[model samples]
Target: MRLRSLTLACSLTALTLGPVAHAAPHSGHRDATTAASAADKKPRPDDTIIAVVNSIPLTTRDVENRGKLFALSTGLPVSGELMDRLRPQIIRQLIDERLRTQEILSRHINTPPEQIAAAIAGIERRNGMPQNALRDRLAQDGVSLTTLIDQIRVQIGWVQVLRQELGARGRVSAKEIAQREDALKRQDGRTEYNLSEIFVKVEDPRHSEDELSFTNTIIQELRKGAPFPIVAAQFSQSQTALDGGSMGWVQEDELDPAVISMVKQMPVGAGAISNPIKVPGGFVIITVNGKRVIGHQPGHVITIRQAFLPFDAPLNPEHVTPQQQQTLQKAVKIAQTVNSCEAVAAINQQNGEKRPSDPGELQLERMNPQMRSLLEGLPLNKVSRPLVSTDGIDLIMVCSKKEKNFADRSPSEIADQLMNERVEQTARQLDSDLHRKAMIDMRIKLKGV
Candidate 1:
């Protein structure tokens, strides 16, 4: 699979699976690693079974591992009390995963080792962790890397199941694309929001209280500087978890009635997490990235080629290092000699490409005033003087600049959106059907979890 597809799939897969728990001690609670070790030292003949799905047993050890994983992923303190509170949701998630895994095997879906490796790699890349660092992190926490790999296998296979179920409906025709485009065009002055969300599902009405408690804990972590995307990937029930809970741009009418007023009132740039808003299935936590008038906002889309030279140390205005001086001189020479974007790219390659030569299409209006002012007057193909920063100096060449409506959606994007919607619907339906047919036996009380 392509890296982007795998990255998206990796996030989608961990929606219900918690990372492996760390054994580290936290103040004011019984140590998780110690507790696990104590249990291991017990005279029990075999690991106690907690649940059974399709005649396959899930053990107390499994529950502990999942609970610990949840704690590790959320930065929550690991304690027996916390595990007790998390038990119900953890078991429910495990049950759903078991059902999905069973379905995957029945369908004979194959997720090769390479694909799983790629997914793991993608996870590290997104979280800014280095190669093999995930495995190392899990190991240090006293958990096996297999804990994550198994979850990814199920998620990748489940995606295939949904695609297979979708059949021809997965393909969106030109007519449908045209219809969506027309609808959006008609919405021209109406406001639309760019939102990200985390959906905590309440599977049974009787257990709503437990789910709400879980949701609140998640919100607390989010507000305390935990990464939203990572949290959503691990906990959200919505399919948008695949895209880090991104809902993309949606009009007010598209949101739940309860969410509309809240989103409308939210100030942009607050990065404020919403309270648990009751929705059709469960509670939804949302954050607004931005809001704009539909099809009305217009701005220039600019593409530039840049050559960046790095300094061995951070630049100091009062005490410049020799390396910094040499880097500036190199930047000046490249800027003076470079006549085209290709030439700039070549220079960047020669400098070991410390930075990307092409920074993709940038919205000119979104840039800071200083950068915007410099670019507005910059002529095409002429390299600008060095743009100094603490780490490096950049020589820029604007390759293309043009005005366009930012709100417009391309046909391919529309098609993907429609497909994702259909897949999400199919997933919920299939999950419900699996639960309806499966015989799951809970042995939680007997296992004392």
Candidate 2:
């Protein structure tokens, strides 16, 4: 069975890949007098050095590309004003990323090309795009594919660095697992929250105000319906940014005291975005996706294998092409003849495995009524009728079904959770050390930014 792990989150991190490169005057320029005189002499955004991390020069072009990336992720209409607004934060993030990148290279951490390809493929799959569609999308928007490749490379390498730093602590002990399990048992009937977060760090105490302003700006955009996961992937300082800021089910004691009170007061499923709340290292923006009573929900968990045939283009039922007709005919033959999940899996493999054959254990109660009803009566090992959609057809087979406590965590789950907590802690400490030791030079400064 494919279970959720840190790898999945790392793959999803590539979802932040975005569009275009732009040049605009922003909050400040380091050599203000020179910039002003140059602009007066010849007005345009030049490819001049904007900053330096160690000896590496960060140019106006570099910052502009990242600004455009942030714009694309928010799905907002790109404008000169928006680029200007995002400049300060984007510069700071890039500087920090440069520090991490340098550290990764110093340690000789190599991110295999296939790993990056897999992550990019994962991005397309999760975004509902066809294979290799990301490159096309980037091209259409004039955004360089290298922008995405570079960011994902660093993300993957940094994960490896964090794991190495964890040393033996990376492996959670049985005693620790038992203790967590006991704690869960003790908290039965208490409230558990399903939450997501975006953390914006303040690098220097003197720039706390600047960071807070940036946080407020992000909150404003999020409240207007910018996808939180995409924004988090682009900007959050927390390691959970790789998972689109998902915190899963967390309890009262697991959260910071400042955050606990705000989350407790927020209504679940209301899609409420919290105002910036101060924490130890940074400010946090939170949203409550749901809340559930611990140990109270019991439901059917099912495993299924599916075969998917993809359409060359979105299907037009009234104007079916010859290729589409043949695809449907092939699907019909498979549905009629395939008797086992293994057969369906084989069929999927021959079709290039456009989608995974096994989608893992699904919680039946969480599904919509139409889907839950369909699966509840589907006989085990039976090939389902072709489920046609605009872009693909699916044939599913239910392999197993069982009723269990949804709140309970398996030993492996507990272990992964502990490992994640440790990894996040290590990542933060290492990042701070990198910042403290790194030499950074700001070439531009903003007047009122």
Candidate 3:
């Protein structure tokens, strides 16, 4: 199965599948290693059946292992209270996974084993763990590697199923692409929101209150610092759930009026969660990640060269090692003498720093105030004073600066956006159809004890 690796704090824009294989504990939570040790002390009987999907038995051990996986991924403690809160959602997610996997297998779909291995490798890379480390970590947390692998397999297979269902309908023609481009050009100066969503579909109007209560519980968990993407993957019924609920950048006009109103009031920089905005067939909890005025804001894109000097160990401000002191002295001298970006590169190469000489173009507005202020008015070909941190010291030289219009998206960008919209619509339709046709037996109670 071709799986995209999941990150601890996943990109709010990408479609990533799989659990956070190597997440560290968040602040106010138990250390991940300690939590894993505690889980290892308690083991469940493997043969206890919790639920059955199309005659496929799901064991209590399966539920418990998946629960630990969720805790690890979201940085939530695996305490009794937390487990009790998560059990229903975990069961629902497992059921959906089973349904999707069974459908893919019925059609005889095959995902290459190498692709699955590559996805696992990607998980390790993103987590900065060594090869084969994911399996060891899962074992430490009392979760079998199989629990994660099975989920990845389902995700990969389901994607193929969606593509097959889309067939030719997924493609956007040149005329359609042009129409979208023209439309965007006409509305060039409007506002657009960078948004993420968690959509809970109201299957039965009579049960709307139940759905609302369930969504509220998810919101409570999110407020308690559970990672939003992981929660979305586990509980959101929207097509974009696999993508961590990212809707990319969308104009306010493209969304429902209720959602647009919510986005209008949200602030920039940090994400703001909205009250459940009732839409046609569902209630959506929106998070406005950011907002920008189209075609008006000119961002300063700058290219710079940096020479870094590192110490053998982390530098302590109160007690500096002689080696660190010597490195800082060298950095200062280089900053004073370097007259050109080329000289900065040569200095870095000569010192064997191994850092990139050119770290590519960066948006000036996105930088921290200290670095931005230092370089904002700096003339090209001049180096700044040494910027010291715990890891190392850096002397940066401005290479070039240019103003780029953020709203002037190219035709390819427009085409991609159109394709995403089509895919989302198709996915929702197919998912609903699957739910309608599948023989799902809910033997386990998902509500209150």
- Candidate 1 at 193: error in angstroms? 1.4
Model 1 alpha-carbon drift over 4 Å, by segment: 1-48, 60-87, 123-133, 304-399, 445-449
Q: Per-prediction RMSD in angstroms?
A: 6.5, 4.7, 6.8
**What's the TM-score of every candidate structure?**
0.74, 0.85, 0.75
Identify the candidate with maximal TM-score: 2
CA lDDT scores, all candidates in order: 0.72, 0.75, 0.70
| Model 2 lDDT tens row, 241-290 | 87788888888989999999999889887779998899988789999987
- lDDT of candidate 1 at residue 343, scale 0 to 100: 91
Candidate 2 achieves a global lDDT of 0.75
Query: Candidate 1: global Cα-lDDT?
Result: 0.72
Name the runs in model 3 displaced over 4 angstroms. 1-46, 302-362, 367-400, 447-449
lDDT of 1 by residue, 1-449 (tens): 11113234444333223443324221111112233345434533436876898898887666667666656665556776566555555666678889999998898899999999998776664443447877887777655677677777877888887777888786888899899889888888999998899887766665566567667766776777656776676567787776678877888988899998788777765679898898988889999987889877788988999887767776889999989988888888877877999999988777667566787999887787899998888999999989998767889999888999878888877777777777778878998899899998865332211
Clashes of 2: 8
Task: Give per-residue lDDT, candidate 3, residue 382.
Answer: 86
Which is superior by TM-score, 1 or 2?
2
